[model samples]
Target: MATYEEVKDIPNQLDKYLVDVRNKSELKETGTLPASINIPLPDLEKALNLPDEEFKASYGRVKPSTEAVVIFSCKAGGRAARAANLAKTMGFANAKAYPGSWTEWAQKEGK
Candidate 1:
C-alpha cells in the first residue's frame, strides 16, 4: 500500500488504469483522485475499459490490452488492498493499493 504523498506525486505516471473503488455516494461527496476511474468492486470487470473512446483514440490507449499497473483506492485501505489483490489474481501484474485513500487525503486538506 502506498502512502498518500507517494501515490499522489506520481499518479499521472500511472494513468494507464487507476481505479477508485469508492462507492458512488462517497465519490459524489468527497470527489476522486485526478485521472482516476471509478469502478466499484462489484462492477470492476464491466467498467474495465478505457476512460472514454475519445480520450482513448486521441491518446492511443486501450484497456485490458496489457498487464497494466492498476492502482486501486477506496475510502480507507481495506477495500483498495482487496481490490488490488483481486486484480493481481485476475492477471494484472502491477496492481497496487493506495491505503491512505480519500480519508487521509481529506485530512491533509491540500490533496
Candidate 2:
C-alpha cells in the first residue's frame, strides 16, 4: 500500500500503476495521474479475465509483467484498496493501494 507522501514518487518510478478506481463519471470529469489508467472497481474482475489485447483495448495498455508493480487509487482509497486486493487475488504479482488516492492527489496538485 502507498501513503500520500509515497504517492509522490510514482511519476518517477517505472511500471507503477496510477489506476483510478472511480466510476466513469468521476473519471470522465477529473481523470487520474499523468500516466494512470482507468479500471473502475466494478469492472476489475471482468477486466482481469480479458485477454491481453482486450485489456489493452479497455485500458489502453497490455498487461504488465506479473513481476511489475502497480498501484490503485480512488476518491478516498476505499475502492482503490479493494481493487488492489482484487488484482492481487487475480494473480497480479505486486498490486498495491494508494491510500490517499484522488482526494490526496488533488490536494497535492492544487486541483
Winning model by TM-score: 2
Top-scoring candidate (lDDT): 2
Model 1 poorest ten-residue lDDT run: 57-66
Per-model root-mean-square deviation over C-alphas? 3.9, 1.8
- For residues 11-41, write the lDDT of model 1, one tens digit per residue: 5575456678878898999888767777788
Clash pairs (backbone) in predicted model 1: none
lDDT of 2 by residue, 1-111 (tens): 877765677777756766777888887787667677787788888977888898888788766666778788899889988998988888887889988888888888898
Candidate 2 backbone overlaps, count: 0
